[model samples]
Target chain A: MTEQLVIMVLLSFLVVIAFGIILLKDLLVAVILSGIYSLTAAAIFVVMDAVDVAFTEAAVGAGVSTIFLLGALTLTRRQQKQQKHNNYFALLVVTLTGALLIYGTLDLPGYGDGQSIANQHPQLAQHFLQKSEDEIGIPNVVTSVLASYRGYDTLGETVVVFTAAIGVLSLLGLRRRKREEDPELDAKRQCRQQNEEV
Target chain B: MKYLALYNYWIVVIIMMAGFYIMIARHNLVKKIIGLGLFQTGIFYFYVSLGKVDGGTAPIFVESLEAQATVYSNPLPHVLILTAIVVGVATMAMGLALIVRIYEKYDSIEEDEIKAIERQHWQENNGEFGISLTAPPTASS
Candidate 1:
């Protein structure tokens, strides 16, 4: 469809823009590009018929992550220096792995034939697509699968989120020390806050 | 052709994984974050693709139950992906906040420099003067 073509082109553009962000010298623009990247992904999700995902992408990608990256930038050097030299050995290893992965994909099922064995096995999630209404009280089959028969998996996923949150807290949420005596840092903090408010 | 859709998705994945590899291997903090975002985009693509049934209509409902019986692409993936997008933003925000702190403490986000400083601290804490008594032959020797 024409729409899918547009989505593909847009995805390519977004990837290029993301690369530009990384390749740029300034850290600030890199952080901003990260937000743009997230927004683009959100838009792509929209074309894919994934409204829920798109919403989350926009909120987290554009809203919160950029703020965090900028803060991280403040803690880092303003500009990254060019690498000392390219390591051919590392590049070789990466290329070899990539080649293998591409080769491996030849075995994968083609786009939704529905007759693919992966689609038919009883163990497959097709039950939800077929006989869920009489069993699970929910209309959304994915939700039913996520919350009911796979409750344990759902619980594991929750734990994963909890662990991720803990990691973020430990990694990022350090409490401020008493800045009363450190006039230099205190002044810097005040200036930063002022810029933020404005 | 029908196969074109599959190829399109694979291309998306390849680009995504490339970004992920950069994140994992690159020392530059900003570059790493860029990689992370690209990797996430790939995942978004995977979820969105899952909902694609050929000739499928949007998940929107019509008043006529009979008309609604026609095939429509699944909407559930879209909903799920939306939630993930929100979470991604939160994670990115938190990550950036950490990067700020890292910059403040180390004054450089380059992994090598941070590691060097950390090693120096570790050495001081452990009081290692040079090589350990039972260490293997040194390259210098």
Candidate 2:
């Protein structure tokens, strides 16, 4: 009962944070609140016993992304300007989609139903969970599945991460060729990069 | 009982729809990206909830096989979500980088302002403006 109460409290806090992210006009406050939102989400994930996911949420969502958002803010305005156009069209689309989503949820099995299709027909999952100790010798099924059974997927994910990093570097990283062509522009670029670094 | 059982999933749906609303309604590019992050987080929660068993413990094995027979939360979703979380961060980083470049080129990050600038360029170049449209005005001169 106490656990349920704690979950309820955390869930309500999450709702508040989500609303703060949406309703806040100041981009900086929203950004900081978004980080808090991630932290709260991580806490909720922890309560749900997803320690790995909670760790990643804390590290990536709250840690790295917050810094990156601040970096992006440095180059952009800190406030969201009052939108001049009516968002009625957006409201209509959002309402339609949200209703459709709610309708689809009606068919979904209840939370934590062990006999549900996803949990019952666990052919692949069974292989990983049951045989993981003998085959891969890892205590953590998540690690074994990630590193062994789904090794190729992990490799692809790594490649995706590498590709994204390369894309960012090409887009915003210092350019040797451009720097060589114009010394004055190079100096300005250096100053900005130094400021960002600090 | 049914409503209580499905309450968590309903919350997930609400959060997801809220993220979708933000993505659609917000004009600021940064806010749009933030909305996308929230949407992805909602998905992670959905998948994780699917893996949670009513009385299962974390998916860590102990010494004995008989002990391992105890119900364990499905680890598959957790593994998948780990990869997704990393990928989400990388995508967000790349998006922020692109936003930085856009700010540098347009001197404004507002979507409408960026669109207006593009429209002006198209008129000046007779609709032939392409990648060069991103060039700073001073650079073109």
Clashing pairs in 2: none
The runs of at least 3 residues in candidate 2 whose Cα sits more than 4 Å from the true structure, single-residue gaps closed, are A1-4, A175-198, B64-69, B130-141
Q: Score each candidate by Cα lDDT.
A: 0.61, 0.78
Q: Per-residue CA lDDT of candidate 2, range A1-198, in tens?
A: 455456667767777778788888899998998899899889877767678889999999999999999988976779886775668887788778767877787888877788787766657666776788899998988888889889999999999999998999888767623323432344334534443354
**N/CA/C clash count, model 2:** 0
DockQ of all predictions against the true structure, Cα-based: 0.23, 0.49
Model 2, range B18-75, lDDT digits (tens) per residue?
A: 7887888887889988888888888888888888777777788777745445887778
The sequence of per-residue lDDT tens digits that candidate 1 reaches over residues A1-198 is 666787778778776875676467776777777778778877876676555556667776777677766665655556775666665565566567657766655665554444545445455435555565568766555566556766676575556557667877766556753324333334334534443354
Per-candidate clash tally: 23, 0
TM-score of each: 0.72, 0.88
Candidate 2 DockQ category? medium
